[model samples]
Target: MSPRRHRGMLLLVLCWVLLAACTAQPTTEIAGSRPVDTSARAMLGDLRTLDPCTLADTAALQRFGAVSNAGIVSLDYCLLHLKPDDRTLIQLAVGELTGPDSDRPGDPVVPQGALNIVQNAPVPGHCTRRVRFGDGVSLQVSADLLAGEPGAGLCGIADAGAEAVAGAVQQGRAGHRDFPPNSLALVDPCAVLDTAAVNQVPGLEEARPRPSVGGHQCSWGEQSADAPRVQLQHTAGEPPRILHGAAVEEPVDGRRTVLSVVGGDPQVPLCSAETGHIPFGTVAGQVEVAQLVVAVPGETGTDACAYARGLARLAWPNLPPANP
Candidate 1:
C-alpha cells in the first residue's frame, strides 16, 4: 500500500478498537444487583416503636447501613434535619431521594405527609401520629399541641399506639414557628420578633459596625426581643427603604444583638433576587436562632420591613442563649 493509505488503515483500526472497548463496558442498570430484600423489609416493620429522628441519626445509619445497602430503604432523615418545618418535612418525605445508587422510586418509608395532615387537624392538645414510609420503615411522630415546647402536648397517634414511646431526638433544634399548628399555617414567627431586634435602638444606622468586603462598606445593625432577633442590615445599593414600627433592642448575653421586624401594612419582601444572585440594590440580613441561620433576601417595596424581618429569622443564631 502507498504510505498515505497505510497510515489511514492504521487510524481506522485504532478507531474500531476504541469503539469495541466502549461497547464492552458494563451497563449501570443491573436488574437484580440491588434487589429489594423482603427479609430486610420485615426488620423495619418493628421500627414503628422507634423515633423517626433517632432512626435518622448517625447511630441509626450505622445500625441500618447494611440493611439499607441491601435494599431495605428509609427516608432521608438528613434533609428532614435541615428544616424541620412541617411543609419542608412533607416535601422531602414525598419528594424523591437523590444520591448514590439507591434511586429506588417510591414514597418514603415513613408516611410523613399523612402525619402532617393529622397533626394540623383542629384538635385540641397534642396528638401522636403514625405513618408508614414504604415497604421498609414507619414513622411515629409526636406533635406538640401549642406553639412552644412547654405548651405542646401529644394529642394522639393514628396508626401507632399512644403508649409507644419512640426516642427520636430531633436531629436539629426547631426554629421559631418551625412547626406551627395547621390553622396558624406557617408565618414567619420571627417577623414580629426579629423586627423588634433590628429596630430596637435608634441611631442603628450610625452605631452599628461595618464589615468591609473588597472596597465596599458592609454595615450591620441589630435589634432583638425574646426568641426573635435581627442582625445588622447589609445593603449593597441605595439606602434601604425604611419600614414603619421596626425596632431594635439591646444585646442579650453581650454576644448577639436582637432586632424586631414587625408585620402588617406595606409588607415588604426581604431578600429579593431577580436571578439567583441578590441584586446590587438588594438588602440582606441574618437571623440566628438555635442551630439555624435564616438568610432574608431584600425585595422591592415602599417599606423594606417585611424582608428585614424574614432575613432576621433566617439568620437567627444556631444556638442562641435563651432571653433572660
Candidate 2:
C-alpha cells in the first residue's frame, strides 16, 4: 500500500506490455487501405469452362526466372514451374476453389483491383500465396525448394506469382477452354443427370445440382445427411478394380459400366459406376471416364448398385459417343 510498492508494480506491468508487443504476430492488413470488389470476379466467367492457365502471366513471372507450363492438374488448376536457380520449382495453382467452410486463416491481403491477394503459411521448404475472391474461390501460388536447394527468398517468388495472377484477372486476360464439338470436354456434368433422376435415389428426392468449381463435376444433396447423395465427375483414368463387394460389369448402349460398393462400414458405403466414353490421350493408356457415385447414409440398406445401374442407363444415352 506504500508509494514504493506502487511504483514497482507499475514498472513490472510496463515491462510485460513491451515484451508482449515485441512477440505479437502481425495480423493481415489490406494494402492501399482499400478492399477488393467481389463483382470483378464475374469477368473470370463460368469456372467450368474457364482456362486456369490463362491467369498464369508468364511475363509477370519472368522477373524471377524462366517460367514453364506444368500443364493442367485438374479442371480447376493449371500448374506452372518457375526456375530461379534452375532447381527451385514453383508450382502455381491458378484457380482452385475453396468453399466457405474451409479453415485456412490467411494473412495480410494485397488488393489488386477486384482481387485480394493473401500469403498463406509456409510449410518446410515450401511457400504459398493466394488471390482470394471472397467467395471461397482462390488462385494459389506455391514455391517449393527441391532437396538440397536453399529456401532463402522462396516466399518472395510466390508473392510475385500471386501478383501476376491477380493482375491477369484484373486486366480481363483470363480465357476459356476450347474443345471439339464431338469431344466429351463439352459435356456439362450437372446436365448428365436430371433432378428427377437424382430424386429417384433415396435422400435426394428434393436435391438439386451443385456444380464443382470446374463444372466438370457435380453433386446432389449433402453427403453427411441421412439421405443418399449422388456425385458425377468427368475425368480421365481407367476404372477402379472393385475391391470389397460385388464387381458387377454391365453394358449400357455399348458403354462398358463397372459397378461396386466400397467402404469400411457395411451400413454405409460408396456405390460407384465408372464408364469410359472418350479418349483423353494425356497418357497412352488413359481414356475419358464418367464416374457416377451414390453415397448411402445410415441403415438405409438401399440397393446402391441397382440405383447406380439405373442412373448409368439414364446418363449413358446423353453422354457423347465413345471415342468420338
Estimated TM-score per prediction? 0.19, 0.59
Give model 1's clash tally: 64
All models, RMSD in angstroms: 25.3, 16.3
Q: How well is each residue in 183-274 modelled by candidate 2, as lDDT tens digits?
A: 55668878877879989877778888776555566778763434467777665444334444456667866787777664423454556687
For each of the candidates, give the backbone clash count.
64, 1
- Residues 1-324, candidate 1: write the lDDT tens digits: 112212222221121110011112121222556433222123232211211332333332222111111111111111121112332211111111111112134422332221111222324543333332222222333332223233222332222321121222111211111221221112122321333344443333233332211111122332222112122211111212223344333333333332333231233322211001122211243121211111232322323434443444444332222341
Using alpha carbons, what is the TM-score of model 2? 0.59
What is the Å distance of residue 19 in model 1 from its true position? 62
Which 10-residue window in model 2 sums to the lowest lDDT?
A: 12-21
Give the lowest summed-lDDT range of ten residues in model 1.
13-22
Q: After superposition, how far is residue 209 of candidate 2 from its true place, in Å?
A: 1.8
